[model samples]
Target: MISLPLFSLLTDVAVLAQHGPSDVLITGLTLDSREAGPGIAFCALRGTATDGHKFIEIAVGQGLAAVICEEFPATMNPATAYVLVKDSAEALAHMASAFHGHPSRQLQLVGITGTNGKTTCVTLLHKLLRELGYHAGLLSTVQNQIDEEVIPATHTTPDAIRLNALLARMVAAGCTHACMEVSSHAVAQHRVTGLRFVGGVFTNLTHDHLDYHGTFDNYLKAKKGFFDALPKTAFAITNADDKRGPVMLQNTAARRETYSLRGAATFRARLIANEVHGLHLEIDGREILFRLIGVFNAYNLLAVYGAAVLLGEDPMEVLTILSGLTTAPGRFEPVVSEKQRVTGIIDYAHTPDALENVLQTLHEIRQPSQQIITVVGCGGNRDAAKRPIMANLAARLSNKVILTADNPRFEDPLEILAQMQAGVTAPDAAKVQTVADRREAIRTAVALAGPDDIVLVVGKGHENYQEIRGVKAPFDDKLILTEIFAELNK
Candidate 1:
């Protein structure tokens, strides 16, 4: 609904390429050429799988107001309007922010980025801030929220146009704060370009998105780019326990702060007791009990506490308020069936580091007689490098391990399972089994459990659908566990 002269947006970085009507009022913006129309600007970007530049001719044929691309497509018509920018994706971000009235500047926006705890940190921020009597907005992989409105999310970080638009809606709804998850893919591709963040939190970095970044250095660079671009006014809070956590803020101009459990830090926490029920932590100087369990939750709690303090909340009040809040959904969500005394934990740990963290946490708290059974899988079309590592970790850490499909996508489910099975060594081979069908995998895990056993279903937590061959079917791990447990008891 924002209308401005075409030249007003194009005058700075764009060069006219066979211009038609430079003063035409623009009404919409998009990066995909398929969405281009008479009054919309099409931003053609070079993506991982394909380049948006190839669809320029078809977009121009549809009479788009302007086609913003890198080289001004090879076949340019004299009557067709075109605006050439140095980088189409980056330009789209700035343009989209402008079109949305720069809502990020209106509210205090905090970006939480890292490999494991981005979702939990942001989710805690939104829920905590709202409970403390402030209107807050959330943009996370689990879902998107504008004050009280909930919207389904298709990506961890949405495209630039949708991202700005969502922020603008939050501003319009009178939101005073916004918490978002900044993915490496989004940062590398400049999806968060031109958005002002008041603060940025680094959870931790690990082996998750190697398929797109292609290398560890490239992945690290992409994460550091967010901190590097941060303004001096913004505060950078990081985990001092992670070796690379301090490295994340090394080049940033932002005021740096650290949070840790391993040693003394600007904001410090000590894990008093890590039980399945909750965690007892000594935060700053005061002892408090929190309902979130595990060492990973300890990191998440510290990050949330640090971020809340930087955002100008009272130190004690933040801890006191946080102590009552439960852990985010499907993150080590524990359930018990009435048939017998057994614990079934549903978590979203998929990466090697994340899986190891969860398994080690279990190893720390599990009783002498309590056994561990794990059902985990790597997603199709994702970091194939982690499949074997995840398999090996599950086999090594659990008394029983079931290899299953998380989301097969386009790859054959059995093929993905076979690749995972290759990681099981001779000693671990007797403990591992392949159940390509995820539901059956869950059922088998539940059936194999004893009175004092725990079944940890990792990967695809909080997700309600199973994606296979580009189609998403209904599948919920928590629901399946409850159904299986109930059916067996009946």
Candidate 2:
């Protein structure tokens, strides 16, 4: 889609020599050899499972004009052009930026990083920005959007090449600002390298992703990379209430702004009341109302407000925009039915902290006579340490806990449930029931709930597929909940 001077713009000379420059043109850029084309440039990035070096020959034979790789092959054709670098991934990021004309530098880029709340904060910020009349591009765990076009995203943070390409498209589409969820894996992999961020937001860090990073300390270090890479003019907005928030502030060089629901912060939320509809709070001494339930959401709102203010938006205007927003897909999304008076909320709370927060929030809002019921499960082959923790919180906070399967990738669902059940110390372990089928589990939980009771379907928020032994089956909690609601109403 973008035309550039092929001969003059090609940085990897080894690629140019073999291909011969004839009206030099690169139609597209890709890292995977399978996706490469005659005119495309293949970036040979080294990954954990496979080395891109092994695929360089395939890329070259497929008519790729150049190969950007970390090391050059001795058997490589002298005519083939190769750009060798210490880190091919980082080089790919820079090349992608160059190829895209550095689109991020032209727009106001807001990046949010943390163990939790990254998706919620980015989604809320995108909505708030659009409501304020700014054409905003959003990239998160749920989806990627530029203007009206929606692209399915496989990772929370996309590769640098794709990221830069998306930003360029957003700019061409007349977008002025962009919000992105910066995941720890992306940071560790340097997928976001060579991009300039205008503002950085930190939600909170908790135990997760230990499989990839190996330890909590490593995870924290990977997350800190984003703040360390921010531009000098960037503003750092942090959740002062989180124990790790202050540590992030100490690590960043950017101008710092803090928000919290506890103690002192640049922007603070004081909860006046909590109800089924949402929360009533005073933000920075100003009365603001939100339709999002739970104290945790109040913290999320405060972070958004702090980031918006740092971007020069009015405080009251931010509140007004947020008031019109109801719920993010899969994130505490409520499903209502006239016949079934029970309240159903779908949330993406897989980790112990997230599960605890959601359950505790719902517990706080439950009527004295009403019971709290939760359906939750852990993803197979992930951080198994969190399984018992999540179970403990679920049993402790709710009257009933339905243990079900969630992304049982190559692992037995019953085995996963047993691990989680190990943490429930309650005498009423009978309250915990195991259902490997997620849909059936949800149905059973909802069916057991009374009109006054609250049912929470946790994990897999905004996700549409359920992974079982490496195959993704079509499944969505929201769609199922909508169908159940319609049936109950009818």
Candidate 3:
């Protein structure tokens, strides 16, 4: 569908290869050989666990016009064009953008980065933009959308070729705006290198991805890359309430806009009223009511409003659109039983900060004599340091806590529960029970909730699959809750 000439898009053929110049017209770009087609250029990227270089020959044999590899092959065929690059991943992003005629430049692109709230903020912006008469697209952990059709997402941030392809699709579909969640891993790995973001948002940063980056400083640097690459015309939206927000503001080349729920902010949310059903707040001196609960979501809404304002939308208009916005899948998503006396919530609060924020928000709206019970677990092979912290927060906040397995990939589920148990030192430790099966955990948590009690199922929010070892099994928190709720009513 893209009509750009392939020869014109090759910026560094010599860097990618030491071979001769060929008159091959590349029609597409890809990193995986399985996805490569005729006339496509293949990028051989070396990932942490898998090397794409191993598939160079297979790609070339499968009718690829050119192969971009980290190093030139000693036995490459003379007929096949080879380009050598120092870093194939970065080169792929740059070349893919060029090949797609730089579709990101044609649209108003916004990139939001943080440990949490990125998906929620991006989804909110997408909804607001559509209500404001702009055709909007979104790419996030939950799903991918271009106008009306929704596509399943394979990664938090997709690979370069697929990313450009998606952008081209959006452009073709007449999308005037798009919002994307820029993960720290995606930024560090050059996943979004060539795309020009019109606005960048930093929600907040916490201790996460220590296993991948090795240190907190490295993680911060990776997140800073999003704003550092922004153009001068772009706006950097930051959370002034976060301790690291000031530091992040200092690192950007783009203009700055700050939003916060606490402390002084350019766009501040003054809580007018809080209830279990929704929240009422005064944003930027304007009283606005929203259907989203929790103080954390108030921050998320502020960020969404700030970015919407940067795009030239009216504050009240944005608020009106958000006031009608429903909860994202599994993010503080509420479930009701037949009698509708008990309300259940499912959220992706795996970290200590996320858990504390969600629980505190529930406590604020809870009725007198009502209790809050929680079900949560820590993922295996991730930052094990946060397990005890999350447990301590849950123990201190909730009336009851249930520990269970959350994607215990290649690690014993019991070991993760043991680490969490260390932090829960209450005499009512008996209130906290360990369930290795997530489904059973959810059923137990829901069954224990009284008519006035609110139950929360945390971690693995919108995800429909449970990863164990290397396979992903079918599982969805929302689906499970709906089924259980139906049975309870019967």
Candidate 4:
């Protein structure tokens, strides 16, 4: 329903050469050739799987009004308009924003980015804003929201066309604030090209997504790119504890601020007590207790508090609402059995740093008599270098370890387990077990546990399906653990 003149969409795009009429009205924008039609402009994007340029002719044949590409077709269509740009993805983003009436400009958008804790930070901010009596929208890995209406999310950061559309819908729904997670992939692919963010938050960065980036430097660059793009009028809040955290703000023009538990920062907190129940902290000289657990969450809470205060909310009110707030789903969630007194923790700690953080937290607070039994796995077709590292860490930290399948997409699950087993040392090898089936693995971990022992089902937190050979079969770690506990009671 949003239509715009083709020339109007090229606001900041650098056109190498353009042909045909620039005044054609474009009603829709898409990169897929199959989605092209009358009044639609098709953007030819280069991707890992395939290039959109190959299907340009097919889109033109489907009656596309405009074609945006890096190169013009060998045989140009006389009726269709042609736009030659350096990057079609970036061009499409700006065009999509223009077509949607620049909805981001109408709302106070905040983007949180880092290897870990992005989901929790943004989710907390969204919920915190709502608790403060403001209509807020959320775009996160778990889901997208227009105030109370939930929309299923397919990607951590939606592509340009859909991203703008979501913002437009939020604007229409009378949302005054929007908080979203900005993935490194989004910055690399230019998915967030034309949006305006009032603030940006940086949680710590760790080893993640190396399979796509190919190097640690490349991955770091991608994360820093988000901060680099932030405008001078915006605020950049970072974790001073992370060594790389200060580096993220080096080139940023935004007002730089920091939050930390260890060193001096713009906002500071000290961990008074960390227990299985919750956390007690002295934040900025005020003593308060938080419902979320672990040291990582302490950092997360500080970042959330810093961003909220920077946004002009009263400090005491933010802390009041934050004390009762819970963590995002599948993040260190606990399920306990009453009869045996065994505890099961479901988490999404897929990376080496995250897994270590959780294990360390458990070790810090666990009773001396309790044994930590861990069940974990690595996904197929991802960074293979981390497979053994994860297995070794699990074996080193837990009393018992089970390596199982975690989304072996298009790869043999047994082979993936083999790679993981390669990391166990000789002394620790005896305590490690390899189970290719994730369900059976969880069952085995629970069965092996005694009274007061802890069982950790990690790697695929908040996911309800197991992806195998491109098929997502029904599977839920929390549900399975609960069922096992119920059967134990019977």
Candidate 5:
């Protein structure tokens, strides 16, 4: 544990009530009261759903080094110190960084934020840089990495304490550069408050996480907030094709740069060929053949390529390394049957825009005789506005659509399927069927496919567990699809 005097780590905080020693030492920091131990400082954060102030008393009783909150308790332990902060979350972030030795400043940190493509962009960049001989680290929804050591990721952006600890581990492991997906939740909650980001990338903005933000404008503000607070020394990279891309850099002090496929930008790419096998692109007058397919992935590649160029890497080598890179798991990953010529594609397309992009990519490349069958579902405890929209897109794009459950946390599986089925109109009703069981839905889709047919299993791409009623049971779409294919092919 790293212990420091209270004054040494204080940042814009005022001593409200000091009962005993003012020179009391703080050993560690935590936002959660359960983690409060002797000599640990507890930060009482006020959140939308729950107030951290409710647990400050418990921490103090447990012999916490100090109590940090916007409001001090009426009854304070005479031996424990109480400190007041303007913002509890912000103070926690600064405190966590100070306790961890400010590891972000020791490495070249690039943050990628948007509605989608964050995971793929950061994951690919990590792979690309590592392949180029740099000791790189990655933090994405899929996993976390410190050079060669892989750690399972529990959140898109971890809490301030955990984030600082992870960055410290990266620094200790001698990572030269690190790229992470900066979720909007992490931004609004002040998770990355004290971290220094050398660069930031905006992939795109769309309808997502409305369940938490409550409106589209609020969601946009949360994403734009990341760019707005960037330092002048850092670079702000955005997708030129997105309508809100330019708006993201409006108030930023950072240098602005753009990457696009449809318009002129600082970094630009053109699609030479988009086949099922892969995409051939003409990037900055140089042609590149990439193993990853689709227009969405094309945009992802441009974002990664642009960020690399902004970091002062060789343009030719970036493109060359980019061409050899493949997508992260569950992103347009294809598996074919041995006995039959049928193809099955896996993707994490939960949002309407993401779902449409995957389906459109398939329609553009498939043969006229091939029937496109899709198995898709919406996640529970999320933005419900996109459920019907996802259902409508599935019906409009595929010849046959199977609506099923995807991590129906507390909600009933049948209820979730019914909500999606509500989008099926009279004409669209003929192509749709409801199967509450996701595994059965996949089996049905595969059974219906002919030798030349293509099946698309969309949603929950890389996720291995199915969360139902708060229990995570073992369920992997990729593994299940492969097992069914082997059984059918034999």
Candidate 6:
């Protein structure tokens, strides 16, 4: 119902050329031609998969209000408006912001970006804000939220129109702050172009998304672009422990600060103990035990604490609330079979570095006699370069490994297992098994485990469905694991 004259929506948009009427009343905006209508303007975005220019004629024929594109068609409709720009994506971003009345500026929005820990860090920050008696919104890989109301999320970061609309809803619902996860794909595609942030947090960079970015360097640049765009009034907090952490702040205009466990930093924490139950740390000269586990979470906690303080909250109050906070779902979530005493940990460690971190953390904390059995796989149509690396790490770190299918969308599952099998050496090959069925793989790992042994299920942690050949089927990992435990151990 947020109708605006096309001329008003073009306020901050870069216009290279214009034709036809600018007074067309636009009620909705979309990139998809199927959604085009009489009062909607179709933004002809050139995406990696498909070009929106191909459907401009169809959109216009269906009575679109206007066409925003990089290039005009051979034939122009006298009844429709046309605006040409350097980048349609960027234009759409600003237009969407204008349509939504620039809601990001109304709240203290914070964005967290990196290869890992983005979900956990932002989720924690949103929870911390609510604990401090502020209404907040969350945009993350897991879900979007306005205080306690949950909105199912389809992407790590949504497209421009949806992004601003969500923020607008938050502002209207009395939200004072918002925490969002900024993915590399979202930044490179101009999905987050027009949002204003009060602060930005960098988790860490690693080898992932090579298929989309084509190289590690491009991936790093995408992550850095988020901070580079931050205004001087905002704050940029990064992990000092990561070698590439400081690189994020070099060109950023925002106030630069750091947090680390291994070195001195603007905000530092000393890890006193790390157990399966929780982590004990000395943060700002105060020792407190946190509910989240692993060194990765220790860094996430530090990032959240730093952001809250930069937002003008008390350090002691932030620490007090952070101590009882748990991690995001499927992040090292533990499921135990009391009958057999077997422990199962489900995590979303899809990359080489993340898997190694989890395995290393388990190694340091598990009982000496406890054997780690790992079941992991790579998703189809992703960075296949990491398949071998994932298998290699699991084989080297765990007592046993199982390569299984993970969302084989239009790809052969067996072929994915073969690629993973290539990573195991002859010595380690003997301990590895390939199970094409994921549920069976988890069942087998559990049945093979001795009492008190640890079974790790990685890759698709919090997801509730399995995508195969363009079809998504209900498949919750935690639900399946619990059911298998009951049937086998009972």
Q: How many collisions per candidate? A: 0, 7, 6, 0, 0, 0
Whole-model lDDT, model 5: 0.91
Which portions of model 4 miss their true places by more than 4 Å? none
Ranking by TM-score, best first? 6, 4, 5, 1, 3, 2
Q: Which pairs clash in the backbone of model 1?
A: none
True-structure RMSD for candidate 3: 2.0
Candidate 1, residue 131: the lDDT equals 85
Poorest lDDT segment (10 consecutive residues) of candidate 1? 10-19
Which of the two candidates, 4 or 5, achieves a greater TM-score against the reference?
Answer: 4
TM-score of 6: 0.99
lDDT string, candidate 4, 1-490, tens digits: 6678899989888889988877799989999999999999999999999999999999999999999999999998888999999999999999889899999999999999998999999989999999999999999988899889999989999999999999999999999999999999999999998899999999988999999999999999998998999999999999999999999999999999999999999999999999988899999999999999999999999999999999999999999999999988899989999898999999999999999999999998899999999999999899889999999999999999999999999888999999999999998998999888888899999988999999999998888889888998999999999998999899
* Model 6 per-residue lDDT at 67: 98
Q: Kindly report which residue pairs in candidate 5 clash with one another.
A: none
lDDT tens string, model 2, 1-490? 6765545444533332233334546667788999876677788877878998999888888777667777776666554556666777776777778788889988999999998888888989998999899999999999999865799989899988888989999999999999999999999887888888999999999999998899999998898888988867999988888888887877677998888777887888899988887889998778877898888888888888889999999988898888767667889888776677878889999888898889888878877998888899999988899998898888888889899999989899999999999988857587888787888898888888888788889989988999997999999988887787777677
TM-score, one value per model: 0.97, 0.94, 0.95, 0.99, 0.98, 0.99
Model 3 segments more than 4 A misplaced:
1-6, 12-17, 338-340, 426-428
lDDT of 2 at 136: 92
Which stretches of candidate 5 lie above 4 Å from their native place?
12-20
Task: Put down candidate 5 lDDT per residue, 1-490, tens digits, no spaces.
Answer: 6779987777534445445567889988888899997899899999887999999888887888888888878898878877777788988888888888899999899999998899999999999889889998899998999988999999999999999999999998889999999999999999998899999999999989999999999999999999998999999999999999999999999999999999999998999999988899999999999988999999999999999999989999999999888999898889889687889999998899899999999998899999999999999888888888999999999999999999999988888888899987879899999888999999999988998899999989999999999999999999999999999876
Candidate 6 lDDT by residue in tens digits, 361-472: 9998899999999999999999999999999999999999989998999889999889999999888998899999999999999989999999999999899999999999
Candidate 5 vs. true structure, TM-score: 0.98
Tell me the TM-score of model 1. Answer: 0.97
- What count of clashes does model 6 give? 0
Q: After superposition, how far is residue 346 of candidate 5 from its true place, in Å?
A: 1.2
